[model samples]
Target chain A: MITTRATTRGAAAAVLGSAIALAAGTASAQQPAQSVKLGVVSFLTGPAAGPFGIPARNAAEILIEGLNTGKVPAPYNKVGFGGAKIESKIVDEAGSTAQQVTEYRNLVQRDGVDAIVGYISSGNCLAVTPVAEELKTITVLFDCGTPRIFEEAPRKYVFRATPHATMDSVGAARYIVEKKKNITAYSGINQNYAWGQDSWRDFVLAMKTLAPKATVDKELFPKLFAGEYGAEVSALLTSKSQVIHTSFWNGDLESFIFQSSARGLPQRIPIIMTAGETAVARLGPKMPDGTIIGARGSHGAFFSPDNELNRWFRQAYVDRFGVQPTYPSYHMAQSILGLKAAWEKAAAAKNDARPSVDEVIAAFEGLEFQAPSTTIKMALGKGHQGIGDISYGTYKYNKQKGQPEIVDVVRYPAECVNPPADMTSTAWLEGGMKGAKCK
Target chain B: MTNRSTLIGALAFLVLAAAAPALPPWLISLATIAFAHALVVLGLVIMWRAGLVSFGQALYYAVGAYCVALVSRFTGITDAFVLIVLGGLAAGLLAVLVGFLLARYREIFFAMLSLAMSMILYGVLVKTEALGSTDGFNVAPATFLGYAPEGAMLNLALFWLVLVLSALAAAAIGVYFRSVAGAIAVPVRDNEIRIEFLGLSVNRLIHLKLVIAGILGGVGGALAAMTISHVDPNMAYWTTSGGFVFVTILAGAGSIAAAFVGSFAFEMLRSIAVALLPGAWQLILGSVLLITILFVPDGLGSLFMRKTRGKEGEPA
Candidate 1:
């Protein structure tokens, strides 16, 4: 089952005739002309900029630069049906659900964008979905993990380049089932949003399947981006569970760790933070050491013989931005490259012309592409959502990056965990997931 | 009252109402918000007439907005008719509760303490994302009875909706002034003991006035939420409560219709100023507020009133 599931998001990119948004007077007049403007929504400033905004900036700058510099591959420069070159204009989607909607409108109506990119927060992605559908443009998300996005709309013009990290809940539960067979009870303190809710749900279901003996002690929903957890931390500390799981991130998670460590939450239950990898690099020492940590992408971190692509990317990013990119930046690099791969693949498949968005999406269905992170494979499922490699990592200090990276990360190939698209919760539960210890 | 003042008030309201439907989407939104805020301020003008400034106005406003949100989210009763009633009823109940505590206080204590009441609701909303946290709830598209509102027609319908509600609220206050209760409620501000000795319950009158004020404020909030289809925690913030107070002070206690005019002026000025200056519009508003409060303490509403009253109104 694991082997079969790993290959579900089998193809990363490339389809028949996809068209990217194009800018005015950029590349509208050529062989096969197709024109459109893409609205790029990302946090250009604010707390999320370090993780989210910069990566988006890098993707837009690099991709557009690639196109403008004549470095773009064949078909892309050749023009398409509408005589439009892919033009992406960026807008600041900083703060709140309401602000995102405003920026989305400005991009769609004011800037005249036909496609969209971005959404660091799963909640933001949810907010933008209705508008995207109303505008009838392909919205490709780079770094959001709420599984509900896929469930709510399957064939809609939305695509997710990154697979869910919450699948690690299964990986974590699987490890616990095999490693610590006896520890059973658990409690969850999560941000009150879809991502937090699902992270806990998956872990709970997975643990419940592995060992029926496990018990859930308490569930607390602190406000997302709370940046403070005094009350929730106190509640969790008193709950008395053998295990604790949280998926707090950015300043919110960091602030929680700072407060929790002071209250000695680490002294009691083993804390399993799904987004712990994102925290360690910035707050390694501050993070309560030995807290059960798993990077959703990689269980633990490890660096192998430097791949040429990885090295090139690292150098290029540092050369341009003066800093090595993080997971967000790396994920963005992969997402943009994905479009490129689709353009190349579509051209080769057809008369070698600029591709349409439908063609790109078609190319993306069951496609695989290599990235600095891993060989990404995509399974176009419900809502055009795809699943691929979900890696896991534990905290370890890396001096050069000057933070703790997920050490000894395990790359979970698209098998064993992720089910087929039509597999219902009940069907998946009945198969190898019964008697699981969720806590 | 001079015919010119009445004529100007009527003309201003009509022009605003008419231009509202023709304006661009952004300007319409801005003017609509201003009008809603102005409606609430009109109720505050009644309280201010009694020399009592209540800052706890957001209590009713949020109650109304949330009532609409709660009913809309929890049930299928999303018609504008039902939502307006729910907003008014919810705000009325909260007013009944807050008015009890507010009855005893006057002057700065009443204003300060009233602000506290609105702040309590804000705290709860900021902490609860299920209620949309600080981001607030997305007002799903609303219907007006069996007729669905959309496009410029929707804006026109909403404008008429505001006009009808504003007129009803203003007319209710007008009728209240002619009654024994409204007269006595004003005396509670000048001499509470004197009014009590006159064999009327002064606190009771204050409570009724507060409830009326709350309903007006709530109706304003509900209308706002319907027009925007988005509500946030800031709607309940003390700053919002303060904005209503500022508007009422600017409008004075000249007439209920003054609320509509004051709000229209504030909104139009704000929109044009904002479009021209962008971020510095707040500076322009602050200056206008400062100058108005300093030079025209009676409020922008008193512009409709003559320089002095002809009749020696009873002090008690």
Candidate 2:
């Protein structure tokens, strides 16, 4: 009986000891999380996929991988966001606004994402903004160009890492007035939507302020994704405008170039496309050499800054994708970098501990960070909207290299192109661009 | 039998409402949207019973949504019930206007004309900058009887509103199915000439159905607008209409409960497909649709009816 009791006591002690050790192991494992889950949304299968969404997605993939593996250069070379690896859930954004809202809710509630970085379509951005705020999710909008997102309402959780369309139009107008001395007449052909309407309006308003002598000839508003531009081209040709401005992008931009070039519209009139940089690589020589292009900011084949970040990002992107990174890719990189900068700043403030969402958001507000293209300033929309220098250049096709290149790049300061923090883009333009601190 | 089924549906709705608080916010939102869209499918089912398929139901849907948006933007009336009623009236009025011409057509002609009308609305909305054009605009948060709620409470309130509205609509539609007008639908589908010979204007009957469908669609759109907190031109696009039609086909026209069940199932399947195959969700959805058509031609609703009939030992 004594021997049996001793054996039972030893067995119970063994079981109790193992249980204690297992509990200790679980506690250690739960103390420090190795990764943070990010919900990355972009159009994966749709018309927007090839030019804008896919490039953005590609950049996100590379950037996330780089950040996780500590392959990124310098300040952004941190091991992910504040030392936690970023595990991304890439979702497709090729659906209706309602559908996107539903998907976004799923990403936050079901997928349990820490932060959201995506949305290429302005409509989708607008739709998801309120939801993001309601959910208190840290959302960084990469490439939606609508100015109304910030101007319409103030937000705490939502931040745009790229400049809105106002910058592109204002910069294009400045480039046009400076380069083309004798501007007799100008016309615009923008899609009949908010982005198009806003772009055209800003461009026209900027022209009114800069070149008051320029006369408006013919303004045509085509439906979005209207691939056939025969009538539009005919109208442009007949109008004989010295300059033609268009904000067409993706399939519409490509289709317009093909159709307009076939009719020799570019040979007769010098065209200014604010969003032309997106199509340069694909169009190659098909895009007329003298055509003016704006990269929204200092992005794409245009004059992005020659810095270490740019050098590393451009080379890595080219190596991975067999093509140079476009403006969308740059935008995506900047958004991720912005998020990383905020996360690190918050963590540093908290003594190298994992910061909460509120802490990160507080750190992100009005935070200026370096991007491959330009220095991104959270200068507008109550420190939720980003501002960056925009550049315009003339498109050139190199025969020897067999590639499309931008030449004669003219960069505009962010303050010169974007509205002041206190004013809306429309109000600023209508007020003759008061308080514009152009250098 | 009808009373028994109605009682069962009421009991089911009560159970769902009581259980809603225990559900996650995402599931609640998803259910709200599903129930809202089910109203549109219910309208489709109404028309389907009479051998009519209005491919442009999104016309009413958009009209209803835009009405709520415009009213909220301009009038500053955040009352959910009022906005929904106004939305239904606007869409119902539009239906009355379009029904005059639409009631004369049948089959593909009816479908194409409806599509053309919705496209016209889409083009107009896309051009009208005041309404935010193709980018659309956001709708203000809704209130119930002057009681303002925010955040999760707001979501819960909206879900409850949608549930109650859906249940009421289902019950009312159930009653309509037994009435002389609703009972004449299958007869009209089988022999329009016979119905006309029986001293009834078939065109007028179809017009009534159209108006009823229009109101239902509008109510659905308004609820959806409130839930989504935004509206765009895509709401009026043919693809939106196609989705409603797809749900209708999936639900079948056998019973009213089928609309809600089918819509919920469709939404759940879509969410699952999206989660599992983000890059190829459309492919998965297409496959499911193909499978359903090949195997369950009468729709998922028929299965429920068959099961109920087996248990009750009565014809469904």
Q: Which model scores highest in lDDT?
A: 2
Fnat of all models, as shown: 0.00, 0.62
Docking quality band of candidate 2, CAPRI definitions: acceptable
Question: lDDT of model 2 at residue A273?
Answer: 90
Could you estimate the TM-score for every candidate?
0.71, 0.94
Could you tell me the TM-score of chain A in candidate 1? 0.77
Local lDDT at B233 for model 1: 65
* lDDT of candidate 2 over A231-259, digit per residue (tens): 99999999968889999999999899999
- Most accurate candidate by DockQ: 2
Which regions of candidate 2 are displaced past 4 Å?
A: A1-32, B308-316
Q: How does residue A151 of candidate 1 score in lDDT?
A: 57
Interface RMSD of each candidate, angstroms, one decimal: 17.3, 12.3
Q: What digit string (tens of lDDT, one per residue) describes model 1 on residues B1-316? A: 4455446556766777777655544445445566777778877887887778887787787788778877888896779888988898889888988889998788999999988888888777766745645535456667888888665566567767777677567666777877898866567777889988989887788888888889988988887777656666667777777777767766678777677767766655543333234324567667767766765656665543433342335231
In terms of lDDT, the poorest run of 10 residues in model 2 chain A is A23-32
